[model samples]
Target: MTVSFGDAGVVDVLDDEDKSDEAKEEVDSRDEEKTEKGVLESELSGEPYIFDYDSFRVEWKVVSHWEGACNVSVSLTNKSDETIHNWNLSFLSEDEIINPYNARITSEGSDGNKWTFKNLEYNQDIRSGESIQFGFQINYGERIDIPFSYSIDSSEKKVSDSDYEISDQIISSWDGGAVGELHIVNNKDTAIEDWTVTVRTDAVFLTVWGGNIKKVSEDTYEFSCPDYCQNIAPGQTAVIGYQLSGHDTSIEILGLKEWGNKDNTISGNSISDNSVSNNTISENSVSNNSVSDNSVSENKPVTYIESDGHQHIFIDSDEYELLEEGIYLLDVYSDSMTGYINYENEDQNDSDNENYNEIKVESVKLEICDVFDETIWEGDILSDDGFETWSAKDTGFVLGANKLIFDVIFSDDTALKEELIIINREASNIKNTFIELTDEDDDNIYDYYEKYFGTDPDKKDTDGDGLEDGVELFLLDTDPTDDDTDDDGIKDGDEDEDGDGLNILKEYELGTSDLSDDCDLDELSDDYEVNVLGTDPTFADTDFDKITDKEEIDLGLDPLNPDSDGDGIIDGDETITREVSKDYNGEAIDKVSVNIGCKGSMENKLFISKASDKSGILHDTAGLIGDFYDIECDADFETADIVFSYDESMLGDTDESDLRLIWYNEETREFVLLEDSVVDTENNTVSYTTTHFSDWGVVDGKAYEEAFDTPNTPGMSGTDNPYMNNDKFKCCDIA
Candidate 1:
């Protein structure tokens, strides 16, 4: 049974088992997408940002610098295992910087030196391992200096010298030149400040971008990080490429050096650089010195290079010129057609048919939109597949004679104009009656007067009883053909068979059944089950115990479970007593009653329900140790409640708060606790509420001895002692 309350107090119940299961499964599957959408919305709503513990990497580059201004770009990458919907970057610097205000980036901060950058509506979401880049210009007095530390959200990142790892390998080789990437990694806990790396290689006239380069020695060349990116944070990588000429086919990094920590100067170098000068020379002499090496290789290795601080494949000038762009159609189709049911054979000229609409061939021709919808090209479509495809320029319809003009662009950036003509032979008025055909289940068959009752897609109400077939089959679990599913005197639509005080439609909407009298089988009618006991009508035993529901109540036990005392003993076998107290509140309190009784014994476990209400049984488990029990009464607007009590002496300090009333689930073979356990420390009792009956028990305490005997004459320690704890032992008579 399922119950739901929608807007305008619209309540509904659905009772079909299979349909309920499918609905639950669907909801569970969509939970993740719903959660993601919620998080995305929260981020878009300008929620406060928190520090992320995941990894982040960024590359910064200085494009150009003049007397007092410099242009810089930063490529921020998310290296973590999550998608960042909204992102921010903050840093401290002395230079006056301007974060370019555009449709995709924004900036904020009061002090010019302290700046915070945010993503605009266009490019905010960044997936893992993807990057978002933005650029800005800064004007400083003297030499431009980059910020020391950088932060994303509220998390800070830094770098040091030990964090610097270097790699320089040959990508491709030719007779006298080679091109490769120079990759520098920051692996420390902080950011590197004002850093410089020197590489010793035998490459003459080596040109690398994203950094400034100068010769340091006869065989050594030094590279400085871009002015805007001198501070390299931890985990961030800086990559530069070398277009080498008159050098060896292979590249090597013999030694290196780093200096000038920006954040903490006292920390100095964290690790030794990979490049060191062997034949040292002054900065002035480096311009005049050159290393001599000449080698060539045939095998070409492809590698990556950082162009303007962004990722790109390394390509020489000649190869770059060979790259060309062309125009291609992505998709084309007629949006006016309903499904694929067009063109009739007999009524080809019948324009009077209401189902058929008229269309002109020339008006149906589609226009070709350029890539990215840019105006950079005018192209003619030479040919296309004769069908309405996702990428075709027009829907291929034989609608009389027609001609289309196309302007196309080739790989050489040259445009051409051409004409295309189409001819049609079959000419007639077409009736589109099939447009009303439907295959809602995607089973490839029309449902109107063609499919079976359950499979009919066009008719949801097959029997037309004001109830949809889906509602009857899946939700109500009733007969779609017969108005009265139970074959009772009243129709199913008009009868509340379950007598739960709700009609069948209401029960269907609330996911409750209206087909059985005692849906829970707790000796309670469906109406009383919900209104009086507040229990589930579809559940035989609300607590899922092994004992028959009504038997628990007749045996002076809790019908909601198999165990009542919670001492590992079923409620039917446990002895119970009652004491009336006026402190309890509710209307149903006057109807509450307790009865204890004795019955047949099983393995020395006494069945106490057979005794009268006024009788008592006395027995000892371990010579002097004994157990006591009692019951309290209460009520609510919906349910009648009872709190069973056991003294703490025999229960081994089991407090009322920790007591959990549980019953054995026969189907799953596991103990499941009732969700309505209410502890009353004031009365030293634990109570459970249910609309039905089942043998119940408390599982947390092992105070009560089992019915099995020990090695004595009676054979067991617990079996020898059998007695009832209360005087009022009788068969509970419940109407």
Candidate 2:
């Protein structure tokens, strides 16, 4: 009897002596057993185990099955637009795999249920829409269970050195050591995983973080990702910091490699084999089987031959010529006019060639196309001098990579086609170009602008002022020919044109505009906001107080402190004021006169009372004529005048000349005598002018010092007057 498995879960049985029913019953029993063993009916009927992923896909199938062992075949297909290299396939299975072909086992689980396989050298690269296959024999005791869940990872092609950019920033430096961070960015569309960066430097690393480090050579160190971060996605960046025991050391990135994919796992249930329509199995043969040679051979120099069995006519030995078969970088602005390819036919020595000596060029045509293969420029090249040189100066190439095709016809009716690829970059990449013209000083400024601005084309800085001519004329909008455009003694680089306390050079370093004092327009000068107030000049409100800095300062408030007075009210929501009053012997004088002078409106009332706390008094001999006056108001006052009229009995034995008005300093916790007080002896009044109000009173200067044993200063003890310790205070002899 013969059993065959067909497509769409179809099974055929062949038997003799009319035993078809028994064979069908046996097959049914086998199916029931597989179902009981947790195997899906679709999987037993030759269905491939499909693992779908974003970048690639994997298909696993059982080609032939026997009682105890079966042959399993696997195929990896690239689904993305990029080619995959250095691929690895991993899965979890209970069966034992033996006699594996086409792939090598890299790792296995301790219980022998897990496996990881890597590609052979020849099959390592799988181009887009292409698939590679490998197979192995699976031995199982009970039933064969296919690995439905699997993962396929692929390391991308080794990117060119130009695709990676490294930037170093010095975070801090001391006398014998320096700390810096290296920022590595992937400019290309390829993610890098488990990458290693090598740098050549003289400094010895004292400490490192964000990456693992190893010394490769005497002056070289290699850095790789730690456990935390292991990959840098396309157009993404990674930072590695290190502290080294050296100063002014030259550290450069020697090279970087091993670009890979970190997240390539196929999760959840197994995907259907819809993509395996053409993946059919034979009864006794494996499909798409391939084996890899483990031996490695040294690479030899490639010798390129033309299609006509002749040597190339063009040469690529000169830096000014571009006749190679590889990609080249060209500056569109600086190298467009002078780019040319030199033609020298080394095959001219062939005696069989009849027109060797008279190999005159018939016609040459050039065509330029974009990445989409759309023709952008096409023209004919006129060469009356026998085509010694060819140029595409008038092609008008666009930015990015472009394809160039050259079709030439010789006088002997021989036709040839030459191809080249050019990448058009900006003027800053001029060093990679074949030739640069017009800018004699190489300052990135065209000669036309230099002449128009009256600057020397031979010198980068025409005025010898340490600023580039192009930067002065274009960036800073300053005169390039003169060092000082404003005739200010300071040079343009040193002058603070916007009065922001930052010079032009400093502004350029910080990427700030030198012409705007308040770049953010937050109603505050950039100088005061950045240096004095420690606020962000680029932000309108640093504290988010809903008030501008200038308004807060104009209102006599701290811009940094939202609630200036610690009164639980923001400065923008409330008004602050001060008031002073006069009293005699702890009583408000009925004849007291008060005058307030200030700007703006006042809507709140004022309160005047005798201060109950008299701890601010510093002079013991100076007797208080009246209790300290505590005044409060809600309107900020510019000036206030108060007069206290008292009867002659209030003076007692103390003469009028012995009286002095004093104020308590809240911040310093000391007493300050008002030296500018005016006393009217006949009017029996003492008047004083003040800008702010707090505590005020009159004290006699001719009293005994021993009358008080305790200091009157707040937060002090003993008989020592806090003001007496400071030489700035004079509290005696008012008469």
Candidate 3:
């Protein structure tokens, strides 16, 4: 029931099963790739910068000083270095882009209207290496509050980082000799399941965010020492702190002007920087409930570095790397302590002040323990046999033979680490798969091999082939023929993934088919169809057309009657219809054995007709005398050869009683008794006797040998319990 169309276009395979959403989500990525090829290619050139709604993290400030107007302070930078001075500064409010050009300030549309700020302006040229400030004289405008956040989506080339290939998500961190952390926060509403995250530079070394940061969705994840992250509730924030190693690439902020305040334009916003800074500070609070969508928001109250005076801190003697501005130590020398200056507070330049002494040298740690998965390799330790051990640690951390540690010293807070080292070393090798050896028990075959020497290659291979089953399955490819693939014991576990121990003698076999060379795998194998199940191997009727014996018996149809019309193909689908017509030469076949019917006599014995050419042929054999079989013949066939058994032993008949058996009655269209022609016992009464031609001819004193011209022709029927019928053997010459 299959059809194939080579020239047909793609058609839907309509099935009756209702698939769930997961199946639908498995989109054909191939179709998507084909259709999106052009769109992807177009974006490769030009590289126009685009930002989403949540591009920058913004904080807002609004202050009162110049009467009803507000004073504002802002910090802006172009993250993109390549796109240079092509950036424009547009001051936007909910109403207008308050500039002469009146450019649409944000990434949205504006209604055609005539309203904008004109009071505030800066005519000075701003370039790659300069940053300047301007004043705004505020007047009638008030209440038209500006959105809090501000950002510059710059066009920059990203660099790719060269790191090891990671199969699963892991949480770890690397510090470029800085005092800040590389934190990772999970933001999905639902606890992420089976998710992996990797954050590293795409290409160029992002001085701001460097090294590899990965996290797997485990119950607990660690990035640094004792450095696991906590769940941050909604509206919360997390930071990946790093020293902002001096980044000064001519970034310009064309202009800075306020577009909103209550009224429309900043007609008169001329205020001194000194005055605005003071006024803005007075109205600011650091502990405000956090919310999204707003602009510049304050974190800590406008705090300043203690005005005691700047200390000359020699961070990197060779490289002028600006240690990120979180906090700083006076010296990175080992053992330097930190303290506040009380007596030295009055002398801003007191060189003798002991309060200026603070030192911390950064180092990595290699801690090992099995207390939990987080504490396993949070730092630098190799994973081996489930035991967290060994390390090259990092280069910054000293490579001692025993233990490795991180160097962290803090004054304001306890370092966020239980283990820290201040030096560098090398990376450790993670040995994932191994082999072991055992001895034979000398008794069991499995024990001698699988148990005793399975793990240990030396005990099993006798010759040093360097291969083992467990190792091959876990690490090496399952193809056991080659000792090493590409000369390595570890294989790319794709092919032969099971390592099912396939050998030259007993190779792994197909999951479904029988072990027969000549068989159709799609249908039942020839062995199972014919030899094993005793079914017709040549049958195409899976549902078994009424011709096959099973189906005929089910329908109560006469199977032995091949042509129920006396034609061949016993009710077979192989009709005379051009597809499968078969002709069974006028001879009917009776596959007979013993006929034990529900009648008075077990007289149905194997009887060959004296008019065999008239009785056709029966394909029964020697051992079949003890069983019964459904004989098949064509409705067209009027002559059938049959052999039925009459048990003289069961009837207790001594001198075989004259017997005869009747099969299907052509006249009645149903079965009628035919006295068996043979009997060796005296207990049964039969007319068609087997002893002599005279005995058989005297059936019922009618002499059936001459009764109906003898069985000259064949007959179509199921059972072969033979005897003499009064029908005069119509098959001999029905006309």
Candidate 4:
């Protein structure tokens, strides 16, 4: 059949069924068509029909209709393997179409309801196996109906087969080769018992899946679908895939054959002579490959900044200036490192606005070393939001021309490395930089020096004595400028003036006065404070626990922390062990007195729980000894040595294994067992090394009653007991 527009040339659409089956088979053997109308036709057809023109397919549907207005949608597909360019579409309709848009088409001059449309710039080209679509509203006189038929211009002739068609499409491409699929459609009405398709290309097939290989060659291969697809039904398609190697981007479908029809060849071309008109097949454009390099190398972009003055930040840029070689000092605390990137486009106007690529900081590596590569500081710089920070104060720097190398990695797989010479010149200034006088007195010396001695504001020493200042004034209570303010023949430093058995120099070191026997005045003499009690002499109450230090010592309480046990009880109010067996309940039982001695730097500050207060302590109730005692010691003692002295009389034939020490963890609220306890049976004592002291108690609850007996203390009723006062441990001692 021949269809023609008024000025356009005639278009020949052959109706293959009109020809004899033998003649149709001979015509289909010459060329294998690239189009697959079965897929597009099946998508459009509510019913099936014989396909006569396999080159192109079109369908239109009325989306909506009212009294005078109707909406319609159209679809046009290139069933041929060749790309369609500058294509035109025409269709005969009874209704007048209006407001046409979307997939570009020109319908300016219509011919009596015979609407003719031509492709616009954007929709002009349609690649093989692709489709284009457009829609328009039509003003109809009455009811709306589907279009009777549609046609596309076949100005450019493409090779096709009448019996069947085969289309090869490249699915993906890489550096070397590509992977693709070949689609075969059976155009004949009869079932195809078996079929074969030959593909010829510049690249050789490395592997093929989902198809059975009928023949194989260096640059050509023939494959057929598996058993399920051996007998292809009319209008059905069979798909096969293969991976090819080499740089060739062209794929050609040479020939196709079906069962029981020797002369019915889809394409008559032999494998050697079959080649499509040189179409470049690629997954994506070769120029738009997205692979990038991520290796780190020394020869990369870098930046350097000077550290002589107050500036402390170093950053990377395309046009960065290098600093002059010099020895300079830099404040490490003020140092900062930053990195950025510049993205430019030639099409963009040259204004202040800049295009910045989305770049991320992957990692940052830095190293500081002398010329000998002796690493002073080698580590990774902390990175956040594409910036890094590092300081010399944090690394405890050295004082030389240190070589600092910074290596940074960005998300784009690019790296930047910079090396600089940094010299720390003012290392000594760091100590005195934060120090100031803080002198309260008018004297040249600071107040701290005057407090320890009696210095005159006019002269270095009063009384013109040979000895300077405090030896006579504060240390000995004698006038320093005077030869001898004291009428005694001996100088103050030479006399035991305080009569505490310590001479003047020893008293000064001991912070005692020559005139006063007791400086703290807590009824403890200066000698006792320095030698026996080990309490501070300057303050009357060393721990500042309201009660005088002397009273705490007399009560056998720790004079330092008010809440020694950390059970919310002060040591002063905590029950004391006065002759272990002497019970407060007016009951004296057979019990052995055990004296536990502590020997460590923290011995004087350690909290010891007496057996009398153990059973009645509860964590939440007032006037109750908490389950765990708080053992707070001076931080100086990393570990403490404790020895428990008990004889056979105390144990009463109890095995040593029954006696063990356990520690309580306040955070975990559980008791942890201690190991490696040394027992010296001959010395009648057991010792344990305590790395830390919280609440420690001997295991085997029987040890408490077995060694000594006392009446059970009543539980706390939220009322204060005469013996256990919560007021003493309220943490209000200092205030």
Maximum-TM-score candidate = 2
lDDT of 1 by residue, 343-384 (tens): 222332467655344321111122321111112112222223
TM-scores of the models, in the given order? 0.20, 0.25, 0.18, 0.18
lDDT of 3 by residue, 79-177 (tens): 322212222332333432222121222332252222222211121112232322222322323332333212232221211222112122213322211
> lDDT order of candidates, best first?
2, 4, 1, 3
Error of 1 at 477 (Å): 10
Give the alpha-carbon lDDT of every model: 0.41, 0.58, 0.26, 0.46
TM-score of 4: 0.18
Worst 10-residue lDDT window, candidate 4? 2-11
Error of 4 at 33 (Å): 99
RMSD of each: 35.6, 26.4, 34.2, 35.9
Q: What local lDDT does model 2 show for residue 409?
A: 63
Candidate 4 lDDT by residue in tens digits, 244-352: 5544647788877643311111121111121112111112111222211210111232221111222223534222233432122343432333333222223222454
Error of 3 at 303 (Å): 6.1
> Could you tell me how far off, in angstroms, the CA of residue 265 lies in candidate 2 after the best superposition?
13
Give the local distance difference test score of model 1.
Answer: 0.41
**Clashes in each model (backbone N, CA, C under 3 Å)?**
68, 1, 109, 14
